[model samples]
Target: MATKNVVVDLTKREKLDGTNFDMWHRKIQYLLNEQEVLETLTIVMMRPENGNTAQHRYDLETYESWVKKDHCARFTMLSSMHNDLIGEFENYPNAQEMWNQLKISYGGTSATILRALTLKFEKYVMDSKHSMAEHLRTMSTLIRDLKAASNNLSNEQ
Candidate 1:
C-alpha cells in the first residue's frame, strides 16, 4: 500500500523555546547559507517575470558557472527547492518589482500563499491565547534530539 501523504503548512508563527518564531523563515535560512545562495536565488526567482528566453538561459549558465567556480561556497544543495523556485531571481536591482509583477501575472498565487500562511498563524495565536509553555517544551525536545543526532554522527565518523 502506498503511504498516506500529509502536507504540512509550516509558515505559521509557532512558539518554541519560550519565543514566537517564524517556522518557515527558520527552515529557509537553515537550508540556505545566506550570502552564497542569495545571488543564484535572485536570478532564478526573477526569471519568470522577465520571460526572456535568452536572459533565462544566461542566468542558468551563470549559475552553473558560479557553482563550478566555487563562487557559491556558502550555499548548500539543501536549499535547492527555494533556489529553484524564487531565490535565484532575487539578485536584480528591480527583482522586488519583478516579483510583484509576477505575483500579479500569476493571478496572485504568491499573494494567496502568503495570505494562507498569515491567516493560519493569526488563528493559531488567537486560539492559543498566548500560552506557550507547551511550545517551549516541544522545542526543548527537538533541540535535545538534534544534539543527540549530532553527537551520534560525530561518533560514527
Candidate 2:
C-alpha cells in the first residue's frame, strides 16, 4: 500500500474593496461553502435557561463555545481578506454580524453609485491619448459595473 497526503490552501482570496462588494461576496460565499463552515455565519448558539441540570448546562456551554469559536475564526479570516477597511467590526460576536456590517456599510448607498457609474458608462468618450487596449480596459471595467448592477448594454444601445 502507498500513503498519500493532500493539503489545501486558500490564499489570495478576492478582496471586498468598496467598488465591488457583489463580486467579492459571491466569491467569499463559495470559499465559505467549500470549507463546510458557511452556516456559522448565520446561526448562533444560545446557552440554556434556568432549571437545567449540571450536565445539561455543561452541554450548552460546550456548544456555545464551539459556535463562538467557529464564528470567530471565520470572522477573523474574512476581515483579513478585505481591501476596504472593516476594522469597525472587530468586536462583532459572530460571522453574521461581520457580514451584516459589510452589507450595511457598503450595501445601502450603492444605488446612487450605480446610477453615477451607469451615467459615466453611458457618457464614456474614447481618448486619443490612450492606446486602444487601455481604452478598452477602461470601458470593460465600466461595463462590468453596469452588469453587476443588473443593467445590461445591448448591441443597439
Candidate 3:
C-alpha cells in the first residue's frame, strides 16, 4: 500500500497578487496546470465515508491528500495579495470557486470590460507633440488592454 503525501513549498510571487488580475490569473493558471492540479480546481474528489471497504478507505485517504495539496497551492498563490483581497476569497472551499469569484469581482463580465476597452482604444489619439516612443507606448498599452479584455482585432486594425 502506498501513501499519497505531497510536500508543498509555498513560494511567494507578486505575479499572483490581485493588483494585476490578468497577469495574476495567467500566472496562477500556468502554475496549476503544470502542477497537474488544474482539474482538482473544478472537480472535487469525494470523501468516501460509511464504507469500511479497502477501496473506500483508499479513496477517502487519496481524496483528502489531494485536496490538501491543491488547497495549499491555491492559498500560497493567493497569499501574495493584501489581507483585504484575501477576505474576499476566504469563504471558498476550493481553488475553482476562489478563482471564479476573483474573476467576477475583478474582471467583471467579459463583454462589459471589452466594450470599455474598445471605446478607450477608439478614443486614443497620439499627439504630434509627443515623442515617437511615447506615442508608441500609449498605443501599445491600449492595444494590450483591449487584448486582455478579450477583444480580438485583425492586424489591419
The estimated TM-scores of all candidates read: 0.23, 0.58, 0.59
- Please give the lDDT score for candidate 1: 0.36
Positional deviation of 94 in candidate 2, in angstroms?
A: 1.1
Model 3, TM vs. native: 0.59
Q: What does candidate 3's lDDT look like per residue over 20-80, in tens digits?
A: 5675666566666666677766676666777879988889889888888677656655665
By summed lDDT, the worst window of 10 consecutive residues in model 1 runs over 1-10
- Pick the TM-score winner: 3
Q: List ranges where model 1 is wrong by over 4 Å.
A: 1-38, 41-65, 69-111, 125-157
**TM-score of candidate 2 on Cα atoms, chains taken together:** 0.58
Report how far off residue 100 is in candidate 3 (Å): 1.6
Per-residue accuracy of model 2 over 53-153 as CA lDDT, tens digit each: 99888878878776866664465445545533656666677777778877887665467767776778888999999999989988987888778777888
Between prediction 1 and prediction 3, which has the larger lDDT? Answer: 3
CA lDDT of 140 in candidate 3? 86
For model 3, state the Cα shift of residue 13 in Å.
6.0
RMSD, one per candidate, in order: 15.4, 7.0, 7.9
> Residue 105, candidate 3: how far off, in angstroms?
1.5
> After TM-score superposition, what is the CA distance of residue 118 in candidate 3 from its true location, in Å?
12
